[model samples]
Target chain A: MKNFHLDRRQLSVPYLIYLVLFVVMPLLVVLYYGFTDDDGNISFTNFIVFFTNSKTMGTLVYSLAIAVIVTVICLLLAYPVAYILAKGKYARKHSFLMIFVLPMWINFTLRITALKEILTMLEGNLAYHPFLNTVICMVYDFLPFMIMPLFNALTKLDSSIIEAGYDLGATFPQVLKSIILPLTVPGIISGITMVFLPAMTNYVVLDMVYNSTYIMGSLIGSYFSSYDWNNGSIISAILLMFIGFFAIFTERILNRGEKEEQRI
Target chain B: MEKTKTIIKMNNVRKSFDGKINVIENLSLDINEGEFVTLLGPSGCGKTTILRMIGGFDKPTEGEILLDGSDISMLAPNERPVNTVFQKYALFPHLNVYDNIAFGLKLKQLTKAEIDRKVSEVLELVDLEGFEKRSITTLSGGQQQRIAIARAVVNEPRVLLLDESLSALDYKMRKEMQLELKSMHKRLGITFIFVTHDQEEALTMSDKIVVLADGKVQQVGTPEEIYNEPANVFVADFIGESNIFNGVMTGKMKAAFAGTEFNCVDDYETGKKIEAVIRPEDVTVVKPGEGQLNGEVTSTDFKGTFYITFVQCGQYEMEVHCLENYRPGETVGLHVLPDNIHIIPYDTSINNFEGMIDGFVDGKGLFIVFRDFSMFVDAHRLYPDSSVSRGRLIGQDGEHIDYQGKKVMASFQPEDGDMSDDAKKGDIVGNIVSFYYIGDHYSYTIRTDNEIDYVVDDEDLWNYGDKVSVILPKKKMKYRLLEEQKQEVAD
Candidate 1:
């Protein structure tokens, strides 16, 4: 029995090694560079530089604001589509879902280029507006990611629970409110995380659409391009902290939802 | 008994999933107020489909479902005055027991105090008053079922549907909950429509049992009526353990089977063919030569309350349940009381073959050729001094008879033939073409070498592709002279 147990546990060794090598090692390197100066001596100069630069601070806020908009828009568009795919009469039409998800299978850069061309053709000069263009591209690219998680959440939900809601004198809207929405909290949280983090830091999408460097992603890119390793690592570390805070916030929201669920 | 009002009525209801095959065809059932009715059938027999239609989860392709005199077939599940406790309980994992029960009341925008009182009252009804704060996941299967019941009952709809609600609980818990549900039905005084494949549950809890098979209602009656007098072979076989035999009703209180005429209680046409069902418990075991039919005990199982003894009388296997201990291979006689014998009138779909007696062995058996093929019969009763040889059976009269050419009619119950794939040296060769598990045994439709289809039953396992021989024991085969019948003038 002991040998069998050991044999089962050994299957995870490769994954453990990969986490330490790729994830822990890179985070450690970023921490190391964030605290060191040009002489490779320990110092807080890069942190001061990142906090004091008005351009970097302004870009960070602008990136956050744009990510919030993109996340909101993606959620608003994806929730209903996901619900229709997962629970509606046409739920078994996997080929219809394939239509929404087919673009994801193509090369990312090629898909963005094609989308840029279509939007350019439709709006002409108006499509070139920097913030609007960036927001549109982010929502377009991240909407599938948002839908996927929400769809998974809605699909795993026991259909009988919704029926039970209806059987107990609740109308369609009441069932959705009392059962479907609260049950899919995990999916909504994951969708927000998936779209929010990428929308905050994806400079390539903004560059391909707007042809301008205006967000923290672009700021980080310019720092790396100039070979400012110390300041670049510091900004990267702060962005990691931002994601960490957001993750905690989402966790808090999930816990609060769970608590409310129990009280109900 | 007071005249009960009909709370729900399904009129000419038909349901089909794919439009080609109907799951429920032309079904009409009336559920009385405060009565507990169970739709009992095997899987895929449309019991659940009926429940779904009544609960509004599914709509019938045709016909109307009346709820208290109004057609509610087109109404949504929420709009109907009905609720359901699903098989899996379907309690919201996110909600506590109190809230789950209070959900219906809260949806009506009831005041907080009203909802709380109703929820608490329902929780008390299910015997889980203190479980108000417990999470649904934390409860046991029985508790969850109770909570599901509480959730539905809290709505106080005109009718409540339970789709095998206690099926998930352990046997002990199921028994307990069955009694609890009966009492709850009395207390609530609302119509309850239940669906289950378990006959014991249906028999114990239902005021009315509707036995369904292949999208048709076979019998609908009280538990005692369904148990004592089954409508047909399917109902007799499906309800409980029964010793069903092919018989002919010769007169009122008289039926003939297994070469002997016996008294029965059922009154039918004198010349009508019938199938007789005698419940195992009603058959008494007497001394070898004392009772109606003599047989040897093949096996005996001591069931705590009584011994289930299997007796072989000629070609018929009769099951007898009694407290008396009997050794295997002991000679015994089965005394089936007159009233205990139930006669179901002839079903046209039974297997009746016209054949000729091909061979005969004096004091041993006879061989009958059917459908251009011959099968052995182990019966010992035949005309004495009859010129019977290979394929010919001639009576005492001096007649130039071709033994292999005489015609006869053979008939037997589906359960008579014993099937075996390795019995290659038997009297008949057949392929195990198709089979369905009819609860107790597998009912196989075997196609003989002559391309004749015969339905047979086997307790032993056999697959679809098996090449097998069906051995029809002579004592089990029932036959009469077709030529003799043709000679006689029709009435």
Candidate 2:
């Protein structure tokens, strides 16, 4: 079972246990609740109701749109910052990386609470609008998740590759484009997954700051509060499926990047 | 043929990391078109600094660097008509061999067909014709090195700088690449300035070698001139194996050492101390009595092509290379032809010899002088006038006669002795004050009963404070009286 050439059994045991405890058990419970009517007869009523509701469908669209927005913003801002931090002088990198990472140390709840307070203050006293406040909060919350991986990818890259490009007569801009940017795709993929997944799932910052925001997290929260367990279960199931599909997509992307690097 | 013209010239280049300490000081050199020059030296000798200056990667703190006789000291590395094959052979990981070679041509806005043609031509030149589409990481170290050369040369720069590019390759591969690079230089006719610390590499490939040490250029010449005729002691010692003997000029053509006088070809200014360098191969071993240098063979090492023998005469051990195998502990005679010997003046500014004096002693109750007692035993065989029957003094006779027994002082010469039985050869003994184990033999410093000093080598183990008799050969000793007479006549 523990042989070096075939350690599948050794790894499978824990994975099986985890699958039974967390995934299988919760999924079974959700399915049980989702299929049963109020009296206990099996039915497809909850899923049907979930699909028919325009409000829940609109919530999904809003959630997906916001996630895409946050992911794009994080990718853009993280790339340049990460590039500069990795290639900049030692002292400059130290100070800039410190500033970029400082917010990560704060507790998630406290950070969101702080954002909420700032948003309220900005809306009331500074006369800023809610949409800009929410965008700013989401970007601030997810930035480090994006920047950390990007920085790691950029810093670990061999400077020789860039030098080779320059020596071969590529201008500075061409080196960055052909050599540096291509080599950093893995980090970019990782940053995208890190920002998109968490932002899609996380609702506290959005709720605390953007209370009226019609997103999936708020819809799920409203269903549970109204004692609509069947509807909530269906919504949760859809969210799980969405996350599963993305997980596979991300893995595929990462693997492709790896293969490309190897080929190069 | 017209393209083969003077490409680069660096004049009085100086650089320093810290404002006060210069790493490359007042360096100047010229690189002709199509010529291969190597900067050879030990580490921290500023060879790399000069290469960097020529490559335009570094700015000279003082002086100017000219490319094709135009000042390009202030130009960036890219703007100069030069490229570098770095020690690491920095290759783009993202680019295939074809793209790596095409990168420069592409940057110049060359058309696709031209770029492809040039890249293929270079790949063929480097013997990587079929490897154009291969990834750089997939290539072996030697292949990568060739690619590096190909990439640099394909640019058709007037000059290419290689900073230890072959250092990463294994010995056989390095040798192969060296030949390849040399042939490539001949075919392309591009100026190549190589920087390496390996003497053999510089000797094998370079048209000229510039030897550097301590941020200064020691000598610049062909491999034969640098190796056969070194400019100074540093260059002599750095370039190859050399046996150096420190001595003072005794006559117009004579240098006395180890109780023997040798006629030297080069004349030194009178009274000046100088060192003589002879290649070990120049020394020939013969029967003890027949050769000018008589010494006991302390040890012999058999290196496949030659036998290296260490011989001890008096206090100094001379290294001699001979073709014949000789056993250790055998007494032999060594002879070196006068023309083969090179004498270089010792720079007294750095090495102060006065501090080497052992102690001051009263000689003949007159002049008080410091004694190098070890030197005296070595001197017995060196001073011709000192024998068993006669003695010679180093002091002025008038001073000793003036102060005799009043404020008694005296100075003694090891060469000053008599040949009488009471003080005959091998009769005057001294107590060994100290012994230094110098590899194959022990150098013993003995102080005689008359307070005179002597130095000699003993193959046999002898402890400090042991009583040892000094053996002064009669023919080897001389009286300075005749030399004094000659000096007076000449004056």
Candidate 3:
């Protein structure tokens, strides 16, 4: 039994290595930097500075607002596309799926650069505003990520279940609300994650598109680039904590969904 | 108990996939409001297509389908008053049992308490009371199947279509589920149209069986009618084990076979061709000369409860199933009583002799006449000395005729009969092409030099490519004509 336990532990070695290298080490660095002074002495002054600063507080609030905006936009764009892909009677479903997935194949930086070019063209020639350009870029960059998971969930659903709903005297609108919407929660959660997290920390797209927007990611990047290592690391640690909390929360939601699925 | 009248009527329904080829043709059926009807047939016979049409998942290309006396051929599946239990039991995998069952009710804007009550009731109906809180994926195959059933029944649709719903279950579970479904049908009193290729299940559970073949309804009746009185040869063969024989009508209500005459109740005129069918269990074996057919026992199979005997009487071979045991090489008399025999018009298009035959020369002086060949000469043999002549055979149509009414005769030497008469006029020296051991005896296929195939069965096994002479008995040879041939009686 001891040897069997050892074999099982050995089988998990690669995952353990990955967790230690990426997750644990990064978190330890963030924690260490979060409480360290300018001279590298262990202190709580850096955290105090982070919490007391009004600019940091405003950046945190701005980050949350941007995350919510990105999530709502993703949901709006993805739901109908996913529904059509799931139930469309077209003969070329695979080809349409390929078209939806094609945008994801390009490098993220390249796609953001392309979006920046399009935004610059719109502002230059079409007189498009800055805030609108930011929204467009964020939605465009993360649309495929939002669509893929939602499409998978919707397509995998049993169509007969919908028919059963109709047979039971449920109208069309009611089916969409009760059956299609609630059943796609996992995909919706995943899609929110796909859009929210990236849009929160993506300073590159904001830098190219927005002027004088002082977003949280922009503030962090500016601090790091100006060589204020202590302030930058403290801000980075704060952002890391926010992301960690939500990641764990999202993981818990997913695990609960899975358990509920198994129980049914 | 409230008894509802007929709710769904399919009138002259026809479905064709390619516009030219009909998958289901002119099918008319009615389902009583609370009765369970099963559409049973082999694969590709359009049984499921019929069910789908009734469910409104598929629309008939021609004709009308009505639900509660209202035509629903144009309605979508969701608009129809029916729910379908697909073969795969397409249950919602993402939802728990309660949510899955309550999904439909919730769609109707029902109160939460009412939805919960209905879900619980259906859960109890399928005997999965505690399963309401269980995840659908965690359930066993049988449990999941029950959940699917519960999900459909909770809505209380007017008609429930089960397309081979019990097929996915294991044997033991299938038997249990069949009983459960029957009781559920009794309790719910809803119209149920079940589709399955399993005849036994259709026989055991359904109030009516609709037998389909080649996209057409072969017969529709109660289980007893389909089992006892089949409408046609296909129905008879498909429903049970039947020994079918091809015979010609000699007189009204009388048929002759293997030198014995039997009384058959058929409405056809005298001298009409017909095919007779008798179930294996209906035939009784007796002493050789006393029964309708006399033949040697080519083979016998001992099946634990009874014996299945195969007898070769002249040109016809038949199977006789009895409780008494009989052995091979024994001469057995087979009796098919008049009540046991069912005669129908022969469809010669489907059944025809397409084989070769080979036999040894038992006697040399046997005369042979080729019924198909009218003006033919033999070059390889000598003629007989006693009035050796080639004569134009005279008949009612006259001598030297060209059509089917003509006959010809050729005489040969008796001493050279081993070579001349060994190969009869209709018989060709053929090589044994193949042989199959079908339990009792070996059935052989012989390929003649004339490119004709003959199927001949004997207890004696022959090897492939073995050359042998064959004789076609004149009395055994019968022409399959488009119309009956008039026979002249000599006075």
Candidate 4:
């Protein structure tokens, strides 16, 4: 009995070992490399160089712009589909939602390559419209992420609250504005988080679609491939910080909308 | 007494989903201004459907829902001057208490100062004066109910619909809200239509009660009339604890039931079929041989102040409310007073089925074909006005009308039905689906092979699913014209 009791708590042993070795150690190594200079002296030389370079700064800003645009477009496209699916009188809603999610289950490289072909066929030359093609590919790849969270949150909404809105003399549009939009803010925020954070760093789509432009993910990759460990580690840390900021921002929006976990 | 204005009237409302079986049939009701009317029934009885139709959430399949003498059937929920407090008190979780209450008022585009005054005033009315800033999720269920009511009433709707609003709360909280809602109804002086399956809540809160079952209105009256003088078996069985018995009127002032005859106040004719209902509290317990009937106590359940003691005099058990405790097997007499005995006429709706008028033979009889059986009944039974002469039926207007291929409805009373154990003694063999003791005899439902169910009353008990033969009397069958007979009569 005593041995079994100990084993119950010891179940987390392998997970903790993997976390410390694979995750924590790599993060510590990145921190060590990021704080040191080429002569092995601890310094902020890499940060000063990355910040002072207008090219890298412009790439960061362009990546942020792409992420923002992709997120807004994904939200616009997913909200109505999720609402209609969740409004639910359709006999096979899960199968209907599956149709929306089926593309996400495909291999990422194959799906992006197919989208690149479709884009090339549509525009004649993908490099001629690198920004548009990348945005399209990024949205296509990350759409299911936005759709799943939104569909989940929307299906969980108490429809009676919407009826209560109509009962309170709210018209259809007014009910959507006053009741549904506010209630699904948490869903909208989660969709934004899933799309925005990934869109910033997913340079795979950029490379697959067009290589003329560089996002944060490609900048970090180029630095790492050149054996510039100090600059690559610094860029990774900055991207991680940006992700942390995005998470905190989404959390504020989610909390503001009174997430369902707060319900009794 | 001053006359009150009719605030809402439902005219022959019928609501069916998918154009199939109707959830609500041709139901008509009237609600006066300032009346607290409760639509009370079991689940799936269309009480909530009625509320939804009234609140403009659902449209009737065929009906005119009039609001203060104007048809509001075509109006949207927002366009209608009615509001509903939903069953779960559907408070918008994203909005604060103040914003939630001010929602409809803000839609009216009132000034901010005026909106504030109105919101706070309605909040005070529901006794949630200081809860304006409270988040809907943070407040308790009871507080949410108050705020929901406040939100709905702030708009000053002409009629307020509550679809089992208090049903979500705990027992004690439900009781408190019942009283608070009653006072709110009185203060607002607006028409309130509340729906609940809980009969006690309906009795306590409603000035009038509309008892419903199977999408049909059973009875509509004051709470006392509904409780004391139920219209039929459904209302009597649904309202409160009732010892209902299928019996007959022994005389002008007497009722015979429970294997005995007793004085009753209803002036039903002698030998007329009826039902007698006596409340548990109405039976006065007496010494053995002192009252009308003597019995031994079968069971005694202590209910706070009084014990509901069941006395078995014969096959039927009588429930009596007594302050003095009685042990099982103790002998006692039950005195049921004349005024206490509520005599309801036995409802006539029975085995009605769509049938075709097969033919009429010159000298024999009128042939009617129902499911799985064809029979010849008297011509006069179809309608007292018509006659079968020379192989053709004459209409009420004396025109020669072909009766074959015409549609009709064949009906018979339960009392006219009989059951036999031997197949040779009856027309059709069936299985007894269920049997419940009703004072003097067991009321049974028997399903035939063709899926036709016949409700028959018999003195002998039958087990469930027991095979029996039904004796459907030819003379007892009545037929009514279905469609073209009316048009012919009008022509």
DockQ of 3: 0.26
Q: Over the stretch B343-456, how does candidate 1's per-residue lDDT look in tens digits?
A: 888675655778767666554557666773666654333344566545355666856344455676777777777776666655567887566543235677777656566778
TM-score of chain B of 4: 0.83
Q: What is the C-alpha lDDT of each candidate?
A: 0.84, 0.74, 0.73, 0.87
Candidate 2 Cα errors over 4 Å, as ranges: A1-16, A27-61, A89-99, A112-127, A229-264, B1-6, B17-21, B251-262, B348-491
Q: TM-scores for chain B, in order?
A: 0.76, 0.70, 0.68, 0.83
Off by over 4 Å in 4: A1-12, A125-128, A252-264, B250-254, B287-290, B356-437, B440-491
- Give per-model TM-scores: 0.80, 0.73, 0.72, 0.85
Per-candidate DockQ values are: 0.40, 0.25, 0.26, 0.56
lDDT for each residue of candidate 3 in B30-117, tens digit (9 for 90 to 100):
7877888999888879999998887776779999998889999988767776887878777776677898888667666789989988
Interface RMSD, candidates in the order listed: 4.1, 3.0, 3.4, 1.5
Docking class of 1: acceptable
TM-score of 1: 0.80
Of the pair 2 and 3, which is ahead by lDDT? 2
- Candidate No. with top lDDT: 4
Per-residue CA lDDT of model 1 for A210-264, tens digit only, reads 6575787788778789998888899999999998999999999878766644543
lDDT of 1 at B266: 83
lDDT-wise, the better of 1 and 3 is 1
